[model samples]
Target: MASAITTLAADAPTLSAANTGFMLICSALVMLMTPGLAFFYGGMVRVKSSLNMLMMSFISLGIVTILWVLYGFSLAFGTDSGSLIGWNSDYVGLSGIGITELWDGYTIPVYVFAVFQLMFAVITPALISGALADRVKFGAWVLFTALWVTVVYFPVAHWVWGAGGWLFELGVIDFAGGTAVHINAGAAALGVILVIGKRVGFKKDPMRPHSLPLVMLGAGLLWFGWFGFNAGSWLGNDDGVGAVMFVNTQVATAAAMLAWLGYEKLRHGSFTTLGAASGAVAGLVAITPSGGAVSPLGAIAVGVIAGVLCAMAVGLKYKFGYDDSLDVIGVHLVGGVVGSLLVGLFATGGVQSDVAGLFYGGGLEQLGKQAIGVFAVLAYSLVASALLAFLLDKTIGMRVSEDDEVAGIDQVEHAETAYDFSGAGGGAASRSTAAPAPSAASKKVDA
Candidate 1:
C-alpha cells in the first residue's frame, strides 16, 4: 500500500485511502439495488411473468456497464458543451482518466469515481422496466434501454451534475438523486406507459402479487443498500454528514412504513404487507434528496407527507388509465418530487452543503430552485421517453401479442417459466392455474 501511494508521487493528486475505499464499497452497494428491485418487481407481477420481470432488471447491469465505460461516462461528465451536455471525447473509454489523477475535490482516483457513477447509470434505466412489465419483447426492451440512456439519461445527468452544468450552477439541492434518479425514471415510466397502453386485463383481473415474501425481501434489501446510495454521495466517510444521512434514511423509512399502514387501515380496513413494503420504498426515495439536508425530525415530516402522497398517487393509474404495473411512477416519481420539494423547506444550515432553506431564514429562494430542478428534469424526461417509446413501438414493435400476453411472457419470451403457478405436478401449482400434464404414456414412467 505504501509503495502504491509512493508510485503516484509525481501526480501530486493527494490520494486518500479512506475515501477511495469507501467509494468503491458504496458503488457496490448501489449496484445491489438493481437485483433487489428485480425481486421487488417480480413479487408484484403475476407468477407466470415473474422471471421475465426479474430478467428485465438484471439485463440493465449487463448493458449499461459496458456503455458507461465506452462513451456514456464521457458524454455525461466530460468538458462542458454549450451547457447542455459534455464533450471531452478524450475521456471516452476512460482514455484520459489517468491512474494518479484525482477527482476535482476528492482524493480518489478519477477511475474510482467513474466506476462508482457507472452503478448509478446502470440502475436508472432498470427502474423503468417495472412499469412496462410482462408485455415488452426482451430485445426491444434492450434496445429501448440503450437508446433511452443515450438520449435522456446521459444529457440530463450532464445538465444536473456535470462540471459547468446548468442545475449545479443554479444550486439545485439534489443531495443524492431526487431529480436525476428518482424523478427522472419516474417521469420516464409515465411517458412510456402512455405510449404502451394497459396490461391485458387492466382493471378486470386481480393483479395481486405472487409473493409477498419476495416483496418484503426486496424492500429489505433496498433499505439496506440505500445507506450506501445516500451517504456515499458525500464521496467520503470523513464527515459526520454521512452519519446524519444514515440515521435520517432509517428514521424516514420507518416513519413512512408506519404512516402507510395507518393509511391503509383507514382506507381499506386492513394493513397489508404490500403497503408496508411500498411505503418503505416511498420513504427511501423521498429521503434520497432530503436526508443529507434535513434534520431527523424533518425526515419524519418528509416521510409522512411522502407516504400519504405516494400512497394516493398509485391510485392515479386507475383514474387516468395508465398501466404502471408495479407503481414506479407512484412511488419513485411522487416520492422523489416530495423529497426534492421539501428540501427547500427542511434544509437547515450547518449540514453538509451549508445552504439554509426556507425555514432557516433563507426564504423561498431555495425552494424555488428545487422546484425548477424537479420540473425541468421531469418535463424533459417525459417528452423524451414518450417519443422514444412511441418510435420503438411504431418500428420494431414494443408490446407482445395478445396470445403471448394471456399465455404468459416468460414462456413466450424466454421459453422458461418462473414455477408451476399451474398445478403441473398435480400439487395445485401456484396461484394461477394448473400446468398441462405430460402425455399419459410419459407420466414419470414409474421411476
Candidate 2:
C-alpha cells in the first residue's frame, strides 16, 4: 500500500486535484495576512489615528485586488518580456484562462496561481502603510498605492520569480518574498517617509501604542497565516520541503520572540508585550527567505539574530531622525536582509534545492547573489516610491494639514473614531458621541 501510494503520487496528472485544492486553501491563508496587518498596524498608533491605520491596510485589499485581476498579475507573473518585466496582457481580466488548465509548471489551475499571487500583491503595499501612519492624505495614499505597486512591485516581482528575470537567472534565493515583498516595501517606506517628512511630534511625544492586545492579536494572526506564506510558496504540498518550512517558520518565530524579550530585558529592564509582538513579526520576516534553505538550527540562529538586530535597528529612526512610524523599515527591511543573506551562510543540501550555504560548504556565491538581489530591489523601490510620492505631493498633495494631523487622522480622513469610550459603562454613555474636534467643529460653523 505504501508503494502503491508512492506510485499513485508519482503518476498523478499535471492537473492534480490535491495540489489545486492545497493551493486554493493556502491562498485563503495568505489572504488573511492583510487584515492581520491592519490590526497589527492599527494598534501601534495613537487611539485617534487607529481607524485610519486600519484603513491604510484595509484599502489595499480593495485597490490591489482590483488591479491584480486587471493587469497587475499579468505584469508580475505573466510570461517574460526580458529580465525586467512580464508584458503579456492576455491575462488582463484573465482572458484565455481555462478552469482546469494547469499553470506553467504546477498542477494548480492558472486562476489558483493568480489568486495566490494576488494576496502577495495586496499585502506588499499595505506593509508600507505603517511607516506613513497618522499623517497621509487618504486620496494621495490610495493613488500612491496604485502607482508604486505598478512601477516598483510588479517589475521587481518579475525579476525575482518570473521566468527570464535577471535575478532568477542569477540564482537569487528569495523563496517567498524576502526581496519582492518585505525588503521592497521596507525601502519604499523609507523613501516615502523621506518625501513626506516626520510626524509633528515624533521626537517629543510619548506616542505609546494605544492597545498592545490588538497588536498581539494581529501578530498572532500573521504567524498563523505565515504557515501558508512560506510553505505555500512551494506551490504544492508534495514533499518534505513544505513540512520543513512549516517547522522552521514556527520554531524561528518562537526563537525570535524569546530573543526579543531577552534583548528587551537587558536593554530596558523589562519584557514588554510590544516587544513580544514585534519580535514574532521580525522572525517571520527573517525566515521568509531562508527557511527552505536552512536547517532547524539555522532557523533558530536566524530568528535570534533577527530579533536582536531588529530590536536595535528600530532605535535608528530616532538617532537618524526618520519617523518610521511603526518600524517597518527596521523590522521588515532589516529582517529581510538578514534572512536573505543568511541563506548563503546556512543553506544546506539536505533541503529543497541542492544548493548549500557556507556552513554546508557552498561558499559565498549564494551570498553574493542574495546581496545583489537585495541592493537591486532596495535601490529600485526607493527611487520609484520617492518619485511617486514626490509627484503626488506636488500634485494632489500627500500630507494632511497640520491641524488635521494633530487633531487626529481618523476624524480627518475617515470621520470615524476607532473607539467611543464615551459610550462605555452607562445610560448617558449610550447617547455619547465623539468629542468635538476641529473637523467636527467645522460642521457647526457650516450649519
Candidate 3:
C-alpha cells in the first residue's frame, strides 16, 4: 500500500476526459431515479396519501446526500477495517482528496467516483419508503432514514463493494448492486413493516392505485435512467463491458415485461398495465447485478424467472397478512435473489469475469459464494433495520393515529393534497350551475 501511494505521487495523474464526462452523466441519470421513484410510489398509493408517498422518496435526496458527504462515504468506501467496515481519516467531510487525484486505479477523479456513488447512497433508503407508506409518521420516517442508512446501508455497502470487502473478496459477481442495494433495501423494508404493522385498511380495503398514468410515466423514467445505473458501474467504456451491460439491461427488461404479461393473462385473464410496469421493474432489478456477467440469452432467462417469481411473490403479502403497500419485497428482494444466483448458472466466463457458471462448466463454487453474499446482506439488514424501526416506534412513534391515517396521510403529514376538490362554492354550486347534457345525435358513433 505504501509503495502504491508512493508510485501514485511519483507520476503525474492523467485524467480521461471521456470517462469523466461519461461518469458525470451517469451520476446525473442516477440522481433522477429518486424523483422517478417518488412518482412511481406516489401513483401506486391512494389519492389521500399520494403526496406523502412522494415525499417519502423525495426526502432521501435531501437527507442521504448530506450524510454521504459528512461521514457516510468514509465509512462505506474508505480503507478497510477487520473486513467488516472501513475508515479513512482523510476522507472525513470529503476534505482531504485533491480534485485531480484519480480514484485509485480508475481513470476518473476521486470526486467523480464519490459523487457518482453519492447518488446511489441517496436512492437506497428511498427504496425502503414504499413499504412503510401512508401510515408512518413523517418525523419517525425521517429519523429512520438517517439511522438506517448510517447503521445498515453504509456498512453493507462496505461489505459488498469496498476494497477488501468480504463479499468482494469472496468473488461475488455483483457487477452492480443486487446484494448491496436492492436486497439490502428490500430486506430492510420487510423488517420495518413487520415492526410498524399494516396500513389502516390492509386486506379489507380496495387500496387500488389512484393513477395508472403516473405509474406508467414513472416506470418509463426509471427504464430510461437505468441505462446509467447498470452500465455506469463499469466506470469506463474503454473495454466495451459497459456496452454489453447496457444491451443486456434492455433485453432482460423487455423479456421480463412480456413474461409478466403472459403470466398475468394466464392467471388473471387480463394483461393489466400495472403488471406491465411492475414486470419491467422486476426485470430491471434482476438484471442490475448480473447483466455484466451473462449473455443476452442468459439475460432473457433471468428476466423470465424473475418476472414470474415476482408476480407470484406479490400475492404472498395477502396470504401471510403483511401489508407491503408497494411489493418492494416481491420485486426487489425476489428479483435481486434471482439475478444474483443466476450469475452462477448463466455466466459465460466471457463478459465481466473469466469464471464460468454451472452451465459453462464452472461447478457450484460460484453458486455458494452468491448465496453467502445474498443471505449475509439480507439477514444483517433485516435484523438491523427491524431494531431501528422498533427503537423509533418505542421512543417517538412510527405509525400515525388511526383516525389521521384513514382521513388522509397527505393532509395530516404535509398539510397538502395531490388534488383539490374544494372549488369556490364546493360541489353544491357546481351541481346547480351545470350545463345541459349532450343529445344522443351529438355523440359520435364508433364506426
Against the hidden true structure, what lDDT does model 1 obtain?
0.91
**Model 2 stretches astray by more than 4 angstroms:** 1-13, 426-447
TM-score of 1: 0.92
Per-candidate TM-score against the hidden true structure: 0.92, 0.93, 0.93
Off by over 4 Å in 3: 1-13, 424-447
Q: After superposition, how far is residue 71 of candidate 2 from its true place, in Å?
A: 0.7
lDDT of 2 by residue, 1-447 (tens): 999999987876578788888888889999999999999999999999999999889999999999888899889888888688886767988887888877886788989999999999999999999999889999999999999888999999999999989999999998889999999999999999999999989899889899999999999999999999999998998877988999999989999999999999999999999999999999999999999999999999999999999999999999999999999999999999999999999999788799999889998888899999999999999988999999999999999999999999999889998888864664676448636556867988987
Candidate 3 lands at a TM-score of 0.93
lDDT of 3 by residue, 1-447 (tens): 999999977685478999999999999999998899999999999999999999999999999989998999999999999888899877889999998889988889989999999888988999998888789999999999999999998998999999988998889989889999999999999999999999987898899999999999999989988999999999988999999999999999999999999999999999999999999999999999999999999999999999999999999999999888999999999999999999999999999989889999999999899999999999999999999999999999999999999999999999999987666454887789988976776655522
| Residue pairs of candidate 3 with colliding backbone atoms | none
lDDT of each: 0.91, 0.92, 0.92
- Give lDDT: candidate 2, residue 184: 99
Off by over 4 Å in 1: 1-13, 420-447
Better of 1 and 3 by TM-score: 3
Model 2 scores a C-alpha lDDT of 0.92
Clash count, candidate 1: 4
